[model samples]
Target: MLKNKKLAVIGVGKLGEALISGLLKRNAVEASDVTGSVAHEPSISRVKERLNINVTLDNCEAIKGKDVILLAVKPQNMDRVLKEISSSVKPDQLVISVAASVTTSFVEERLPDGIPVVRAMPNTPSVINAGMAGLCAGANASEDHKSMAEAIFKCVGETVFVDESLMDGVTALSASGPAYLYVVIESLAEAGVKLGISRETSTLLAAQTMLGSAKMILDSKQHPAMLKDMVTTPAGCTIDGLMELEEGKLRVTLIKAVVKAAERARELVNTQTSKFSK
Candidate 1:
């Protein structure tokens, strides 16, 4: 779907670089078809050396004539970047923003009228082509624009459409999820070390187990509770381990963690809106 399209990524930071790398590595878009803008001259050289693409410090110059413009700037910097390029962004171009806590309305309000905007929240795993993204379209966005946004993210990993109101939940559950899972993995690895396992082997075991479990959830299409039941045989060791987790209130703790994170996400959105309000 993205073939023959020129993409300009604003703020070629880590996530921007990851998307560009994924696009090139997957043959979704050729390196020559992509241009990236960074804030400073030092970053221009960094992007050029790392991605071998055309790099510029001028946001307006970088986005000129581009078919799709990915706004990968930090949320705190979104207003400044949008104001910088708003004049250059044409109505025909698709604008996709990956800024956390920044909404489609927030972006659309900054750009020219009828400029389609898509808000996407993608995690760090996108760097490895195993990410998950939650997408939503602004009022002016058309079906084709939505598809283009999906195609861009699908190059890196999975994409799911959700209502704009639920974006904060998605941000907390998936975008911030990797960090929480990493903590779980670390704790599991420490348990292995306590059980006399080598640190390297323990980490591999913990990480691989988490990966396989997640795959099973996705591939089997069975309720996670059902899968847990399948693993818990009568009076088995797995049941004993599950009991320990229950005693520790692990489920409730995780639920509260996500809830708190979502609350924080909403707060940040309001903060950004206030900071950028006209």
Candidate 2:
């Protein structure tokens, strides 16, 4: 879907670089057709060296004539970047914003009317083409527009469409999920180390187990609890471990963590919308 499209990524940070790298690696877009904008002169060289794409300090220059513009800026900097490129963004082009807590309406309000805006929350795993993204379309967006946006994210990993209202939950569960999972993996690895296992092997076991478990969930399409039951036989070692997790309130802790993150993301929605809703 994006083979012929011109992609302009504003803010060639880690996520941006990862997306560009995924697109290029998958031959979705040619390096020559991609352009990226960086905040500093030094970053210009860094992005150029990393992606070998056209790098510019000017956001306008980077976006000029682009078919799809990915706003990869931080949420706090969204307003400034939107204002900087608002005059240059054409209605015919598609705008995809990956900034957490920044809504499609927020981008739409700052841009020309009829411009299609897609709000996507993709996690750090996108850097490796194993990412998960949840997307929602703005009022002006159409099925075609959503497809275009989906195609872009598909280059990196899975994409799911959800109601805009549920995006805060997606942000909390997926966008912030990797960090939480990393903590779990680290704790598991630590448990192994305490048992006298080598740190490297312990880490590999913990990380791969997590990956395999996630894959089973996706591929089998079964309830995670069912899968957990499969390993947790009568009075088994797995049950003992599960008991410890339950005793430590791991499940509720994770649920509360996601809830807390969603609260913060919702708060950001208010802060972000108030800026442009006026």
Candidate 3:
């Protein structure tokens, strides 16, 4: 769907670079069809060398005549970048923002009327094409715009559409989830090490187990509890581990973690909006 489209990524940071790489690798968009902008002259060379695409420090110049403009700058930088490119962004073009905590309404407020805006929250795993993304459209975004936005993310990983109101939850869950899962893997690896396993082997065991378990959940489409039962016998060692986890309140702790992160995401969104409002 994005084959012939000219896309300008306003910030060629890690996430932006990952999306560009995925698009090119997936043949969704050619290297020549994409342009990227960075904040510094040094970064211009780095992005150009890394992605082999045109890179510039001028956001307006990068976005001019682009069919899809992706705002991948930091949330705090969103307002300034939007203003810089506002005049160049035509109504016929699509604007997609991957800036965390920056709402579609906030993006629309800065651009001309009827410029379609799609807000996406993609996780770090997108760098490896195993990411999950949640997307929502602004008032002016049409179904076609939504599909194009989905196509961009799908190049990197999976995509799901959610009501805009649920975007903060998505941010707290999938976008921030990798860090939490990394902690779990690290802890499990530490446990293996404590049990006399070598560190490297322990990490491999922990990470691969987690990967396999996740795949089971996805492929079987069964309740995770059922799958857990499949591994956990009545008097097995797995049940003992489960008991310890329950005693440690692991489940509730994870639940609270996601809830707290969502709350913080909402606060950050309000802060970004208020900062830009001024």
Candidate 4:
């Protein structure tokens, strides 16, 4: 979908590099067709050397006349970056933001109206092209614009369209979900060490099990509950472990953690809107 498109990434951080790498590996856009901007001189040089793409420290120069502008900067610096590029962004250009808690409305307010914009929340797994991104389009975005955003994200992993209002929940779920998974993995590794396994072996065992389990769920086409039942034979060791988990209220606690994280995401959104308004 991005064939021959003039694309510019406004950051060369970890997430930005992953996105650019994914785009190149997928042949979504040629290296010559992509440009990047960074705050420092060394980062600018580093992206150019690493990705063989155009790099600049000037945010406006990177965005100028680009068909698609990706705002990959941090939320704290979003206002400064947007304002810097606002005058140069044309009505025909499409702006895709990967910054969390910064809404399309907030972007539009800072830029010229009628410039298409899409807000996306993508997590750290995107660094490995195994990410899930939740997308929300702005009022001025056209179907073609939305499709381009979808295609770009799909190159890295899965993309889901949701109402802008629900983007915070999406952020809380899939965007923040990787950290939750990491916590689980860490705890399991510690448990393994306690059970007499070497630390390195326990880490590898826990990670591989999690990876295999996720793949099984994806490839099996069976409900997770059914899959669980398949492992829990009548009066088996698996069932004994399951009973222990239930007794400890593990499922309930995990559900509550997700809820709390989603609430925190919503709070951040509210705070961002309020701060921008002020």
Q: Using lDDT as the measure, name the better of candidate 3 and candidate 4.
A: 3
**1-278, model 1: which lDDT tens digit per residue?**
98999999998999999999999999999898899999888998899999999999888988998999999989989999999888888999999999999999889988999999999999999999999999999999999999999999999999999999999999999999999999999999999999999999999999999999999999999999999999999988999999899999999999999999999999998987998775
Between candidates 1 and 4, the one scoring higher on TM-score is: 1
lDDT of 3 by residue, 206-256 (tens): 999999999999999999999989999888899999999999999999999
Give lDDT tens digits, candidate 2, residues 1-278: 88789999999999999999999999999999999998889998899898999999899999999999999988878888999999999988999999988888788888888899999999999999999999999998889989999998999999999999999999999999999999999999999999999999999999999999999999999999999999988977998888888899998999999999999999988977786455
Question: Pairs clashing in candidate 4?
Answer: none
TM-scores, each model vs. reference: 0.98, 0.96, 0.98, 0.95
The clash tally of candidate 1 reads: 0
Task: Point out the worst 10-residue segment of candidate 2 by lDDT.
Answer: 269-278
Report residue 26 deviation for candidate 2 (angstroms). Answer: 0.1
Q: Superpose all Cα atoms of candidate 4 onto the true structure and report the RMSD in Å to 1 decimal.
A: 1.4
Candidate 3: lDDT over CA atoms? 0.94
- Most lDDT-accurate candidate: 1
- Candidate 3 off by > 4 Å: none
Candidate 1 RMSD to the correct structure: 0.9
Collision count for each candidate, in order:
0, 0, 0, 0
**Pairs with backbone N, CA or C atoms under 3 Å apart (clashes), candidate 3:** none
RMSD of each: 0.9, 1.5, 0.8, 1.4
Determine which window of 10 residues in candidate 1 has minimal summed lDDT. 269-278
Better of 2 and 4 by lDDT: 2
